[model samples]
Target: MENKDSKSEMIKSMAFRLFLDRGYDATTIRMLSRAAGVEAPSIYHYFGSKKGLFYAISESYLEDYQELLKESMKHWGADPMNQILGFVKFAVWYTMNHIDETKFYLRYRLFWPAELSEDMEKHFHKTNDQKEDLLRDAIRVCIETGSCKVDEQTAYRSLINFVDSCTFNIIFSNWRPDEQELIETWQLFYQSRIKLGKGDFEL
Candidate 1:
């Protein structure tokens, strides 16, 4: 028998694919059970309800994403500038490898549907609090180091807007940027936006 963790993972993985392929409202509990290879009640056992499962999926993806961000920070430890660059790298890698998750994530962020329960919406926002806190600290450090001239609000909004736009050509349109091209594009954005002290910044 699969371990409890593996079983739960199977359920989440199937549910995510199914939800994206078929609209959430159209995905019945029975369909989820068939797709995940779990009994219908098992879904309820592991996740309170479909809404609860959605929350679980979002939480799982973001946790992995945040970990990637943290790992990228280890490249050149202790520098505030490295911290933000880590995220830029993470964004590029995530876009290339995690197309499905990225599409789902952008969907919710850009076009939050009415189908989402209020609790699910709040849970989504709450999960990112820690990651955002980390970035804010790094941005502050960049300011202190004279690497980022923008104020906190401008820097934060610019980053958010930056990610939103990154998905445009890659996710929503026909443009398929190779990994290297994506990296250079992000490098340019950061360099231009922050006016990098290291004039020829290359990530």
Candidate 2:
């Protein structure tokens, strides 16, 4: 069972790298099998189809990303501003460190075959809602604690758009901002636009 699990993980890892490098339309089962050092049938045995493999990879990557966000929230304590900043920092660092996963997620998150589109959309939204809830909860605390004065819906949307924009600029564009630049950008957005507090929140 352990060996089977290891082999399955190896296949998924290779498939993820290939999907990241070559994209979903370009990557083939032969490429994945060769890269994974496994028989072509084994790919079917593990994932049923290329799309299935892709779905599995997406699911696993999202799960890991969610856990990282949760950890960032936990590590930064109850201060809403600090939690938000910590999550942003962690997200920027994670994107740089896990370029392939980031690329895969950004590019292919909404791309799916017609038959799987509904299911994929539901799954994606479910995960996204969980992530949004974290931010919404933090913003609610901010409002309650007098850290910031913003409606939860508006604040959450702005924060989401801000983070997505920052991440998109970092990953998809040629001009890459360094760690400090990314951190500062996040801080500036909150401090300037959101008017998070009268004093600077520790980043």
Candidate 3:
């Protein structure tokens, strides 16, 4: 069982590196096998096909994001604003730690085989929408408690869209810099836009 787990992990690590370094289309079983130090046919034995491998990579990345978000939500029992901030921190931290995974997903989400990409998107968006719904529920509670003054769904959607744009831009902006600068500037940006209400803070 331990060897099986190790081999499986080796396959996934090699597959991720190959898919990122070589475009998915340019990567082949023989090449992956060579890089992974396995026999040419061994990759198929592990992953079934290149498509399956890509899907697994995509799923693994998305699952990491989902798990982080869920973990962040643990502190947010009944507060909308806190819930939103928890999500923001999770997005920032996860993207910072898993930069390669973010790069792999953002680059290849729509580039690989169409069917596989579509299926991957479907699964990702389902989890994404579930997270948004949780945020929306918190928004509804806030509205009921008079803590915020906006339509619940609109606040939820607006906040989510803004955060999603920031998260993706931070990951794929091509502005390579110190992670501290990136995270600090982004946190500042979020504070100005989403955390502070419109006209709530001075530049």
Scored by TM-score, the top model is 2
lDDT of 3: 0.69
TM-score winner between candidates 1 and 3: 1
Worst 10 residues of 1 by lDDT: 194-203
Q: How far is candidate 2 from the true structure (C-alpha RMSD, Å)?
A: 4.3
- The model with the greatest lDDT is 2
Evaluated at residue 108, the lDDT of candidate 2 is 65
All candidates: CA RMSD in angstroms?
Answer: 4.2, 4.3, 4.3
Q: Would you list the C-alpha lDDT of every candidate in the order shown?
A: 0.75, 0.77, 0.69
Candidate 2: tens digits of C-alpha lDDT, residues 31-51: 999999999999999899998
Greater-lDDT candidate between 2 and 3: 2
Q: Which wins on lDDT, candidate 1 or candidate 2?
A: 2
Q: Tell me the spans in candidate 1 whose CA falls farther than 4 Å from its real position.
A: 1-6, 113-115, 174-184, 196-203
Better of 2 and 3 by TM-score: 2
Q: What is the TM-score of each candidate against the true structure?
A: 0.77, 0.80, 0.75
